[model samples]
Target: MRNICAIIVVFFMACSIPGYAQPRHSFALGDSVFLLDNRPFQMICGEMHYARIPREAWRQRMKMAKAMGLNTIGTYVFWNIQEPEKGKFDFSGNNDIAAFVRTAQEESLWVVLRPSPYVCAEWEFGGYPYWLQNENGLVVRSKEQKYLNEYKQYLMALGKQLAPLQVNHGGNILMIQVENEYGSYGDNREYLEINRKIFQKAGFDGLLFTADQANDVARGFLPGSLPALNGIDNPQRIRQLVRRYNNGKGPYYVAEWYPAWFDWWGSPHHVVPPEKYTAQLDSMLSAGISVNMYMFHGGTTRGFMNGANYNDKSPYEPQISSYDYDAPLDEAGNATPKFMAFRSVIQKHLPPGQTLPDVPAAKPAISIDDIQFRETTGIFNILSSPKINQRLLTFEDLHQAYGFVLYRTKLNGGAKGKLAVMGLRDYALVFINGRRAGILDRRLGDSSINVEMPQGSVTLDILVENLGRINFGPYLLNNKKGITQKVLFNNQELENWQMFSLPLDDINAIKRSAAAKKYTEAPVLRRGNFNLVKTGDSYLDMSRWGKGVVWVNGYNLGRYWNVGPQQTIYVPGEWLKPGNNEIVVLELIKPQQAILRGIEKPSLSN
Candidate 1:
């Protein structure tokens, strides 16, 4: 009787435990469908990025995904965040992608990893390191040997962390993606083939697939690999596209179905109603088509990691710090109406006797009001020594990736006309002798400003901010922040400038001023502290503040502007301590009030 009880216990354990009890399984791409352990499987996946979400909240987010009836989680591997500098790789802390995948498996979910070296997820430089621009004649997302070598090095390093997790290796990773949406970039079949071989050599020995728009499948498709579609919602269209690309076979997959959209600064917040896509989602599932939501959750594009978009159709539109893509799960991992809409559709399609787990509770939120600044200092107070040069050097030339840079020069007495920075990358604040002059914004195509100088040798300072590199379209290669061209005064080139690198990666290194300086239009750093008795997910409302960046406890919480769209910065409670938590703000423009507050919910709009 004891032996019988033991056998029954083991049987229940195997049946109930999510991933712990499952044995090693085989996942293969048959001619018609995906087979998991010799049985046809439909992948209901949701896209989430590890870099966007805080490391502490990864497990809870994955559990949320499982409860939403998602059998798989899709994620993009950002190369820039992983390898900030050439040959220096960091795969720990928030970047511990191996841990992210393991947690997904622990929640009984498979992973479809998109480790494309060039991922245009509206991330900076399309995931290419800014230093890549410094390489001589190296074109990214091409067959350029210099770019290819760097790509291979990054892929190999990343594979070391994830390749072993493939399903065949007793891990939950199902397949790996090649170069992302290459069809939209170029019709380089040769480059696509090279990318495929690189993945195999890197030890990814599972089904490899290429995802593209329906029309792009022909160009981005490589022989002997699955062709997945993106944004194609119609069931018949999906089947037709997959069949055409897969030699008249099956296994139709929609890799990126965008239920909603991402927003940019100065634009209205993008919110799509659940009714728009609910019917399509239900139809797709009823037809047995595998689908992956573009962003199940877009946590946040914290720090200077946000990317921008530039082309003929639109002006320079930099992505806001909040990556809340209006997804099923909101920015703070709270399930939305859209979540239930998608979950309802996904739940109906589950196999016989299979049921989704209960949805986890939303992360707790606490509010703190009337946070006051204890100290303030000028932007120049934080500057170190300057690199004086004849010609203006870019941020990359000075070995700086993100953040602001100061370009200072002395104009001779009465030496002023239309001050023109020929190629101002993004935005710049002009000052004359410690006084705010005018603004040169790339978004407005304002490079030259009419100015009159005093009859003394006054100092000219142009503080340029890297809004974000161009992430999409043909202008990607031309992304170099700071003054890329000659600075001209009245059409004559200005020279002998002093360059200061303000790569504010270490906010703690900044020493606050002993006395509070008089608040002016010039940029200033405001420091404050707040004690938290309890900690949870919260948003720091920047509605009362002007243009600036925020840092809580030492983590850079990205940028905030009075501009419409995103008005709060997400502060993960894990980054906070129960005692005194420090808060720092670098305000470019003087706000009416130096007061801030921690609000329970996010105020994404103006």
Candidate 2:
């Protein structure tokens, strides 16, 4: 009897060896029969990029997904933020991918990891590190050997942390996407296959899938092996995808179901009605098809990572610092009415006896006002300091990644005809002797403009604003700040440009003093004050101001322009202080003062 008991115990141990003991299940594309664990398991997911949401808030967001009856959480691991420099990887702080996946596991949630080197999520440079732009003759997201090799290295390093978590390895990671929506770019089967090989070599032997809009599935979807998920608003499109990829087999998914949208610098704040979202979500849930909310939580862009878009005709447009996405969860992690409504819909569809945990309390909002600030150093002092390179340097050359770059040059022999910038990325403000003369914007693609030259050691100031990095299309690979080529006067290249790297990563680095007086070509430190007893949410109107950035009580509010669209800047209540808050404005165009007023709602029509 003792020998029989021992045998039984050994058998139980062998059966319970985590994911290893699980049966080898085959997931294949078929007519209405995509299988998970050899069963037709539908994927109900909520999309949230790990890099976009704060690491501390990962669990909360996952909990929100669970509460919405989502069994899967789809996320994109951004390459740029994970590896800012080539060969140098950072998985710590907000860049922690393993921690994020582990948190999802704790919630018993399956994951769809989209580690796109090109995830056009309105992020800075479409999630491609600005350092990649520094590579000579680099053509990103292409068949180029150098680009593919570097991408492979990034994948290899990323796989080290992610491969262990895939479902084949017994973790909750369900499927890994190859590249983002490739159909939108071009039909490059060779490039797609290369990406697939990279993942396979990385030890990710799990199910693979591709996500694209309905029209793009034919071009974007990998043929014959991996199933394709549609990113669409209509439910009927699922049948179309099933016909194309899996001969009528179901378990279809809406990889990116948009519940909200993103806002840009000059455009007014956007808000999607809860009723419309409810209807769309209801249809997907009723159809028994799995869906993922594009962004259940859209966090802040923070620094200079906000990306933009420029059609061949339209002006170069950049996004705002706030990536709120008008999502169910706001930037501060508070649940909106839409969250409550969606939770109700999800509870209706949950399995028997499955109840969502209690909702988390909203973070307290603070109101700060009457803050005071003083500017110390002017543009001239910075220009006089020294030069990093002999020739006029772009933002990329100084190793300064983003934001505005100020280039100054003295008028030689008092000869200045048509001052022209070879390749202005976005916007440029030209000043002569501390006065604004003219402005160049990328919308017009104006290479050179006529400028007047004053006599006797005149100072010339050219302030360049990184409008926004292109987040999609072939243009995505071409991301750099400042002048790409050279500045010229009368067809002659100008030399000796004093470059000031103002990639303002830190707001506390701003110098303030009353005694320091320095000259600048267009030096204007516009100041204002407001009173607040207790800080509440407010939008600071920055519409009247010319091109420049703003700071509230020393916190950089982000770049603003007089251009239409995003005129009012979002000032989070958490960033504010109670009573006597100070505000400072730095306008590149001197002599123009700006007035700021607080509004309850975000400014929509600048």
Best by TM-score: 1
Report lDDT per candidate.
Answer: 0.88, 0.72
Put down candidate 2 lDDT per residue, 1-606, tens digits, no spaces: 999999999989976654434434444434454577667666777777776565666887787777666788888888887888778899997789888887888778888898868888888788888888778877786888888888889988999998888876767788888888888888787888877888888877777777777788778877644555555766787766756676555557677888889887556678887888887787877777777787877766655677888767666667877677878877656788988888888877777897887887775544333234334345444332445455767677777777778887876546658888887887888877766678887766676777767668877778887877889776776677788888888887877768777665554565544422333336455556777777766776666666666777776666666665666666767557666666766666543354557766555455
Worst 10 residues of 1 by lDDT: 511-520
Clashes of 2: 29
Off by over 4 Å in 2: 1-36, 224-231, 379-392, 413-417, 444-450, 490-492, 506-557, 562-606
Clashes of each: 0, 29
- True-structure RMSD, every candidate: 3.9, 5.6
TM-score of each: 0.95, 0.83
